[model samples]
Target chain A: MYKEPIFLQPKFQERIWGGKKLHTEFNYTIPNDQTGEAWVISAHPNGPSVIKNGPLAGKTLADAWNDHGELFNKSKDNHEEYPLLVKILDANDDLSVQVHPNDTYACEVEGVPYGKTECWYVLSAEPGAELVIGHHAKTKDELTAMVENQNWDTFLRRVKVTAGDFVYVPSGTIHAIGKGIVILETQQSSDITYRVYDYDRTDSVGNKRELHLDRAIEVTEVPHQDADKEQSVSTVHQLTVKKLVEEKYFTVYHWHLFGQASELKLNQDFLQLV
Target chain B: MIDGEATLTVDGKTFEVEKGSHFILPHGLSDYDLSGDAEFIVSHV
Candidate 1:
């Protein structure tokens, strides 16, 4: 039996307002022969767990996932669909208020096989960093009026966030990662995001990114005011029901901790491709 | 269930496969038709 819990090095991306912070923290040491990229961890058509020691020393996580599917209960070939995409995002500037379509919407409207459902574990934040999730408007008419009249302040529920906070974002939630924050996001392997608002910011081309106005209008829920309680205060174990407002084809759990351990008993015909 | 490409010598043959990229071989191929330095992960559901 293996005694060590595998360590997954993270991947880094350079976004328009993203900082060089995530690249520095999560990347591991590479040997002289291996290559390194801004993106370190790859949930390739291959897997998520990297082999620490053996003949296949530098092989990727996907390769291990394919070879050892039975131990994790994953189907060898089809297991490529769920890549454990973990990233440390440093938002030097505010991100767009965005919503993701679930599997059904993605498959029907956009013809994507998978949709994004991600969670954020905030590692650090500035003095007044805030996250925009959902809205105070209860009805579609109120939400439309708020967006049309540019009542961004009243429409968005601004929650003051700090380090070590876990925010589960199911598909279709209108949310954004505010500036002055660094976070680790874990989610499904899909990269489809629907932007609702961009804080009126423009790209390098000097054009505002397109907003998914109609879809956001259909998907946004009433603002969740008590999002801070999602973190585990006393212990590293927190079981917050994150998908109360929206449901998806898959369920996810957020574990915020240091030196924590838990046992998982597999009773279902499912796979645990860690 | 197909053979690895590293084993095939005649080479200019292709087949349709959705599940794997490097494991398929042409018809009338057998293990004796293979050569040195060939390895592949065999999986079945």
Candidate 2:
């Protein structure tokens, strides 16, 4: 009997290199505050209600999935459909050079059901903000040589990204969100980023995260390009799909909201918190 | 005896959904279909 829209909060992680950047979680009313932790949002394996509202008011998302699995018709092996993962990435420093695997590859190689294909809506970027996307090298050996030689400037396709730009990153596209950029990312519910190159940074324990050079090479796609397509769809309301970034798996619509009540028919059982 | 059901009438047409069974009445669906005594959950997307 709830009349208002339900909102979910994005759990934040305090990394060793993380700055004073706090993730602002909006539109979620989870019952258990403990579920939103530092690194990940815990979808209780035992099944309990984490959020307080929506069509699934009293039931946990897991319980709902268990009982109404027929609604989604998910396979026997896969459980997660659409997990809520949002990040307010404060790239205070450069992130590792990374690429993502597709669902099929992840399932076969990594034994995971889903792969990550994400979109970035640039909220703001400091002047001279740049992002490394795709490989300047055409072959895997060439990229390997560049990385070993530390020829980063030649190996990366650096773009001066600014606020209000929408970027869609397909799986296998080697990319990195550079320093001084903060973004709101929405993507398929998966967490399998293969870091090809890290700037030789170490964790608090002085242990560096292993670079999956061979795996990344296998997954990396050559010739990464930006989606420079304009938001051309005309609508009466200010709500328009300004930019659309699509990969083989999921499509992200960079929506431009300007105080308009938007109406949309549900395609899959989508969870939209605010 | 069958479990109690509710039939919802909208614009002269009716929709009968059982307590356990549900139907998605598509957006802009002018005509609806039903049997008189079925109960259901209704929502617009």
Candidate 3:
């Protein structure tokens, strides 16, 4: 049985809309100037974090979940890939407007265990930074017409945001993180995305990225449904515990402590970040 | 996180945690102690 906390080394990903804030702000040794994301506490096959402390040092987080199921209170026969992924995304440029399929669609069409239902906690945003959280289309045909007409200004719904703001993005919500904003995202351990818009931006190689309008439109909710989350705060041994969101996929908390907090326990699973 | 340092005690073992430090206190960890000063954002499923 492991008695010490498990530290992890993040795995970084390069992206077209990335920047160097992962290095500048978080002090991480990023791979390049376009270091877009840091998979901080992830076990997904795409970018699993490596353990950095105790007897499991140098093992991948996937290893811990696979080899030591008891560490997460899972049975030895449990074969589900670790279910949650935590990431820090630095959007130097706007991300592509995208949506994800639900779990049923993912299992039937994409043959995956889970779909993507993510939530973002804004870490920082420029003075005038904005985000695309929903769309203005009221029907499937209207949404398709807008996407086909290249009418982004009329089709997208924008919201201004700042540091410490939180947004819940369930599956099929058309969303994008605008430029000059950084966020911590928690979501189901899946990476299936369908892009609808990319601002007509070309990559360094002068090639345009693919747009999955057909799938995106097919999966998107006809009428955008805003996720209204109720938050509550309390004190646990002097630690201010703010329950951020409790949902079917993930439950998050923001904790603040100036002096000391004692006797924090966990019999399930946990991830901690600054 | 703010500028500060703290010692996290778990099962009689202590680990130093500061700004930008991330860790997980896996399942079966019943009790842990923290002292000094620091901030953390934790998640679970």
For TM-score, the strongest prediction is: 3
Identify the superior model by DockQ, candidate 1 or candidate 2: 2
Give all TM-scores, in the order shown. 0.62, 0.68, 0.96
Cα displacement (Å) at residue A52, model 2: 3.5
TM-score of chain A of 1: 0.70
Clashes of 2: 8
Model 3: fnat (fraction of native contacts): 0.77
How much DockQ does model 2 earn? 0.03
lDDT, candidate 3, A1-274, per-residue tens: 7788888899999999999999888889999999999998888989999999878899999999999887888877779899888888999999999999999999999999999999998988999999999899999999999999989999999999999899999999999999999998989999999999998899989999999988999999978988989999998776788889999988887877766787876745655554
Full-model lDDT for every candidate: 0.51, 0.53, 0.87
Best by DockQ: 3
By the lDDT metric, which is better: model 1 or model 2?
2
Better of 1 and 2 by TM-score: 2
User: What TM-score would chain B receive for each of the candidates shown?
Assistant: 0.28, 0.38, 0.81
Best by lDDT: 3
Q: For model 1, what is the alpha-carbon lDDT of residue A99?
A: 79
Worst 10 residues of 3 chain A by lDDT: A265-274
